[model samples]
Target chain A: MVMDTKQPFEKLVELHGATVLRVCRAVVGPGEADDVWQETFLSALRAYPELPADANHEAWLVTIAHRRSLDSVRAAGRRAMPVGEMPDGRSPLGNPGPDGDGVWDQVARLPDKQRRVIAYRYLADLPFADIAGILGGTPAAARRSAADGLKKLRTLMAETPPQGGTP
Target chain B: MTSTDRTSRTGPVDLAFAPHLTAIEPGALHRLRSALAETATREGVLDIAYRIVDSPVGQLLLAATDRGLVRVAYEREDHDAVLQQLAERLSPRILEAPARLGSAAAQLDEYFAGRRRGFDVPLDLSLSAGFRRTVIQHLEGIPFGVTESYTEVARAVGNPKAVRAVGTACATNPLPVVVPCHRVLRSDGSLGGYIGGLEAKSALLALEAAP
Candidate 1:
């Protein structure tokens, strides 16, 4: 399986690297997400020989990414820790402020599944079907999970009073 | 604190973070490509060099390393910014040498000339990881002229709910032309935001869509 000639795979990296990273970040947190992403691609490279020539490569890669993210979460024992700094080098947990309106902090407080789903669906903007495939559920189920998570977030946002309110 | 004082405090807090969200600049784009080439050449690892080419809409900067073409940039962005970004995000040593990027530049020239449809160049995407890499990989599948919805891209990547994050990736695309970030659009068929500006996006789309 001399698959070293697959130039399209390189193109695939240029095109979808950001998308993959976003999903990994959402699921595994930003710090540990890169390791998972690298592993996913490394696996993809190893399995490239076996992939059907005409198969949807993007779909295949995503499936691998989903599994890797889940594995990363499990391996970390769901510690609810923040990933490392963002690409801009900003801290993931966010710098605390006087009124405590740091968006990252609010995001961190979310339940693990909900937080991952929100980052995946909203922040990453992946389709429900793809998310479901990664999460090991039907598309509808994925959508429901995302919706439920969003509802919880809305509630959190609502409950937090605006700083320096009249009341 | 008084109610008015509280309101005033919150306002500045929000504003303080706003500056960090500034858009990419053109000068930074030029500097980045130059720096990347220089560093790569200095290390003797850059087999290819990059040159800044002018297109109808904006400047196009390309990078070629020993492995292949490593990056592309839009005219409106700062080359230094892009280079610094790559250095900070990926590595510290990027060099400048047009010969290293000659092959990529040739292909890109053909693309601009309407003689070529797709790119065949070596890439070094070591700058990003995780969801960002996923998004960039997906962008590669978009054909030269055809476009896909952000949602479709998300679905393709196996996380159908990540549309917003997908958009962010597009906005944050480090290698614009090479990755073809402009090809991704809104699900509703509208042109989406581009770090290079809407006009430049429109121009690229038009070039691809042309017969």
Candidate 2:
């Protein structure tokens, strides 16, 4: 039945705001996620009116966020900051507790492709097919990237060990 | 695994790791919403701002342009559909920025509580035009607690033959309750059609009739 009603831009924000924030934080770091989020949504709001009624808003939002994150990444690369140091002191995941640093540090250490695959797969809850549509390559390749990312992440976490644990 | 649809599945990542990635800072969403509203306004793209208000009648959808209060919708009117309609007719750059409609919401609260008799907020009136606009403008002059027949309004608008047209105007009034469309009744003193349903119309009339 082709329902052509376009919801208010606010509805889109309410529905996907958190997921997009997580995607932004994962693709970029937590320190820069908010800015990327703002840019992504501003762009979305500007183009929302013209979007086809039945288009998948979630996928569309993630695509915009992915592009914006890439832009910021390129911008940061041009600046040529020292490796292994965050621009800010905040934990990678914005986790404040002592135990959080190890988990997010490993995530931040991941190669860009793995980091994004894990993010889009777990955080955004997008299918591999959709993730491939955003990131390029086939659905199988996207799945493989996510699997490799998870395996690598688990290994890193195992090596790090939790801070307050039984000796 | 290729045969299985992956859309319905979750990632193999352990549940414990999920929280680390999804943890949102306190006030993050609040800050985002405020920032979006501000940016949209500053960019001159917030074409229509809307908010919801609770009243003796029901939840009312109050929408305004920079010009002033543009739409006052009843719950029965389907607020979502109303917003979509507004998006189509007006610009699609609408946001839930309450500040623009703050005055209108406050006025409605006062009116429903019987503390205020008439609304003083600026109105866009662009939604209604020609004969409908003329009829709606005449409806504003309708004093509180006083009811006028559609026939009377038709003659007052200088078109005695447009009685049915007057009813049509009142039926399509974008801003009900505030516009006093409930004040217009059938010539036989029977309740006529209301965009907000007959019960809402009766509730509005009863609210006004109160001492």
Candidate 3:
């Protein structure tokens, strides 16, 4: 018997788009987040019905965005600087006021592996198992990496001198 | 409030990263919906059927034409809004028929089941042209379980310096999933920006990378 397996796409968007966008922003920075977000959904639309019902769909889309975001960043590097380097003047972890530049700076300073893992597991809020797959490691390894990265971040935070504190 | 006061309250780290953490505004959703609806309602166009396809992450509102699929939206109450937008942007002929999208819908079903890898469907990409089309066309070549960087895609398309433009094209991709835009990544192997949201993007990448 043929099942009437028609799933509504609107519901999926409402439920998942916000979470997906959050993760994308964290992974790639806001400068190029929206582009990746749009591309992710477009890819989903074409492949939705084929997606395994039992499979973790959220993980699937996040993986796609991650790869795409990475591609864009690499592409930006190959292209002529898009009008000054990525505003490196800002402090890596200082408050940039309402603009969020400070947080982004800190995130940028993170080693590539630590940054990707942290962004995926913490900022993007993905599970370690899923993060592992994205990073091509075991779930346990991914979790350990994330933990180590977070620990280092906390250390970095502690070591940072207060703005007005004596050197 | 003064910058100093703001910094003191949220703390320097919080203040610096707060903007990046801020969610997409509800107004943007409203505007996107409105824009899509307007574009779907333009005059003199043929039927622009739309439907919502439920997936693992969220609902995907897909709009199509007799020629092929046109637009796909994520998370909006009024799917018709995008259809209307399409109508306004191009020509009005939007309708609603699941049967018309039989081939696409079928392929999608197979893909979700993990029974399929790529799609084989005629597309209607009147919304994009020139460099955008070139970028998307090359994007299709990215095999499942494999990925390429935006710069790589640009070079493949014969314009290495257009990597940024390639990214812009990806951002503006009118037909996303079918074109496999999610397979692109950074040279450093980090996730990138996505319009449908990064979670979904990551989800797609994860699915591809899964054993």
Cα lDDT, all candidates: 0.61, 0.82, 0.63
Docking class for model 3 is incorrect
TM-score, each model? 0.44, 0.84, 0.45
Name the lDDT of candidate 1: 0.61
Query: Residue A119's C-alpha lDDT in candidate 1?
Result: 51
The candidate that wins on TM-score is 2
lDDT per residue (tens digit) for residues B85-184 in model 2: 9987786778898877778888888888889999999999999989999999999999999999999999999999999999999999999998999999
Tens-digit lDDT string for candidate 1 (B36-95): 345435545433345677767677777654566566777678775665555444433334
Which residue pairs come into collision in candidate 2?
A: none
Please give the lDDT score at residue B186 for candidate 1.
93
Chain B TM per candidate, please? 0.74, 0.89, 0.74
Residues B165-199, candidate 3: write the lDDT tens digits.
Answer: 98889877776667778788877888776757788
Off-target runs (Cα >4 Å) in candidate 3 are: A1-6, A80-100, A158-167, B1-19, B29-211
The lDDT ranking, best first, is 2, 3, 1
